[model samples]
Target: MAIYKLDTGWRADYSYYDSFGKRKKKSKRGFKTKRQASEWLTEVIKDINKIKNPYYDWNFVDYFDMNMELKINSGIKSETVNAWQAVRNYIVVKYFSNIKISELTREKYQHFLNEYSIGHTANTVKKRHQILNSVIQQAFHDGIISIDPTYNVRITGTKESKDASEKFLEADELMNLIEHFSQEERLSGNSSLSSFMIVLIAYSGMRAGEALALTKNDINLDHQTISITKTKGRDGINTTPKTKNSVRTIKMPSDFFEIYKLFISHKSEWNKNYELFDGRKIATNPNRTLERYEQKNNFNNIVSIHGLRHSHASYLLSKGINIAYISKRLGHANISITQSIYVHLLNEQAITEEQKTIEMLNGIK
Candidate 1:
């Protein structure tokens, strides 16, 4: 091990041989003191030794905890790690608390999944299976198990899928909801940040987190564009968006800027660096507020705040917008993702186009 002092801070570098007798080097920098650097290097060496001699007779739960620690150290996103932890706590641990990793078999795994699917939705069951399968595959790679038990396992869930109406509002309904929020903001004298947020989501189709993380600098009133550069993760504001495609700028409707101008006019002076919405104020279950609006208004269909994004996409589809353009506007990683999510709306559009094609062919004669 070697510790060197730089102009900014101290750095620690170490080299060791792994279990396969291959030499590997590790280095870390930006420590305030040489002592801190030395201590970090020592911890890294200890962790390497522990990995080289992991407990051979560990149960599934025990191994899962260890794997999560390794993943956290390897810099996995906190939100993703938290989701994996949830699956482990709520599903995997309940099913395999006493099962040894090596003793797990295809039959036992399938039985566990079958029981988990008893009352759960298909999407829920699939998510649990995906998380657990990843863990099991990692164990196989580490030689903890000779074969992956989840290789050909079947997943089954009994619950029916949610109706599309429940997932998104119709175009007219969405417009009504937007108008309702706009009127509420007008009546409340622009004191309702949540109201503004709802309208913004309806207009721009940004994720709730992405909208929450927005700042004055992200919006260009002159250009009528909003740049999506970051998101609100579990650990407050993250500097990266959910995906690479989510970093694009979207053109907002001309009317949206009018609403934005009114929304900003009511606020007192604030730094451009500060988030537009107070993070603490809107973080406490904005969905409940949306539900209240739905109940108060006589709308037959209601959706969550995320449903606003869906509603935006559905409204665009209704206006005969191209799916590829919609995909980029929504910042989807690929067009296929947009296609899958809005497949129902796309099917409706397809039927409409087919009829128009038939009418045009008949008119040609």
Candidate 2:
């Protein structure tokens, strides 16, 4: 006899014959009510009585027939699966790990979401909601649950705009920042390092991650160009750029090539001790370096290392660089996105040009 417990506080008791024809009784635990126990009893009896049926096809049954732990082992990646494991550790162990898959409803998910609001930001809440929804969907697909519980639960959070996430330094502010950054770097015995990174992002318009991921091999000082092969995207995949257009090479500053060479030589010398920073492997967490620099310098407008990318694009506009060139240099997925965000600044520059034309025409008359 084998007895198993279902999540709905039900016990399934049964007896089975072993391979050697020995009778065995196994009892599964975790029953809270007689009705729940009776439900499992009925289901178990059917399985036990049908053992002689040749076409039983137990494998065809969904994961509900098995255990939650076994079903989680089925098809998702370890990282993704770990998210559900955390939820299980938090909710299931705290409340009811043995609750029936069919009984866990949307109301329960809503409650979890409501409780989550007090401590988590909307983005964090959304991520947790997504993790829960994924688990529910998997369970439904695997036949563990009759319905997906997370479908109706709403995440109460507004999505932040891509542009809103950034706060770029204006031209004068950027110059001041560079002056401060350079002075701090000089005092630290790494005079050119921080300035070179700033120049690379500002001039090339590369994402902070792609810039940080750079190694000495990725640069071509002789050719005066940089090959950007990878970009950080959602899911943390180290694949191609955001768009196909982003794969193009960037022309380096003619004078800056020598500076890059000098920086590489210094990094290479230090690489003898640290394997990761050996000029061959990717540069590690450049933003942390930027953060320390920002803290030391204490600029009024606090911004992330990523904001340097935006500042670069903004600087290009200020330099009278064509919009198309700026768009391509920034590796914008769409020209429309670049134009829409930067058109107002371009228009302001256009007003100055219009005034110059008027003055020239008036002088000629």
Candidate 3:
């Protein structure tokens, strides 16, 4: 028997027997008028009676996979898809595959974090929690869940910003790396291309993948400028630059131009069987080449191939390039990123200016 109550307001409670013949009670909230209560009761009863859910009825996994595939098909970058997949994999493997979206609770999430992310940085755990919360939100939007289950969850750990531990290569380090590239006696036979790749990555402020994804067509030997058509971003699309400003071309210095030409010529002559680096025509993996080069060269440092990109930004800031220009050149989605990472550099300039002003005041006083 179902119960009806008008204790606070008119309301109807419905009960039904589940598959195991266990009685389940359901109620509706916010039905003030009796007519509204009656309508809501009828709808709720129909819904409760119609649902025949099987065990392990999670569709979010399939939905997420489909959404990721759609993005990849639409020309998003692989790294973006990889990050999302990482989030999904963690949820499935750590939380169990059968965990339903509706069953997610703050306590369970807290427990998961405590167990799996022990000794990991707060930032890492926060990112994982954020991803899971994002999936739950999507489920809500899709009507597969009633509410976002991960809401109001506390993140106990804090993480530094992306550039927290980052420091630019000193001038000596930069020169050493350059000299290392030039020393043929010290290099393995394959070091020449690897050297060029690293130097170009550092000098041009191009992402490693973007540098690797470059086509011969993107490089203008005569004009000494490079066009960056695509880059890897958080969302993983391979379309235009991260921002509209990032889509602009940058001219190389004369010295760089000469080396550029020499490398281009060497690449052209050395490997006639070597195909041009066209994404559409020659779809080789840049990471494979980078890995082999790293293994062969034994270039160990505080950075990776991607670190060259960071080095470029830091070097540009050190040389007094406006943040806006650096931001555009590096394809940063916003000037805020450029400023945030390079804030110390900007502060140093300001301090110098302040010191100069103080000196001038002393002289006058």
Candidate of highest TM-score: 1
Better of 1 and 3 by lDDT: 1
Q: Taking the tens digit of each residue's C-alpha lDDT, what string does model 1 give over 179-232? A: 877763452453367788888899999988888888888999888999999887
What lDDT score goes with residue 222 in model 3?
Answer: 85
Ten residues in sequence with the least summed lDDT for candidate 1: 183-192
Q: Residues 22-140, candidate 2: write the lDDT tens digits.
A: 88675555788766666777676545534633223332122223434564567544344456666556654554454545456778767767776665567777876665565567666
Tell me the TM-score of each prediction against the true structure: 0.80, 0.57, 0.71
Q: Between candidates 2 and 3, which one is better according to TM-score? A: 3
1 or 2: which has the higher TM-score? 1
lDDT of 3 by residue, 11-61 (tens): 677777776989888776555777888887767754653474432245556
> Scored by CA lDDT, what does every candidate get?
0.82, 0.61, 0.62
- Global local distance difference test of model 1: 0.82
Model 2: lowest-lDDT 10 consecutive positions: 55-64
| Model 2 bad stretches (over 4 Å) | 1-103, 157-166, 180-195, 231-245, 268-289, 292-298, 317-327, 336-365
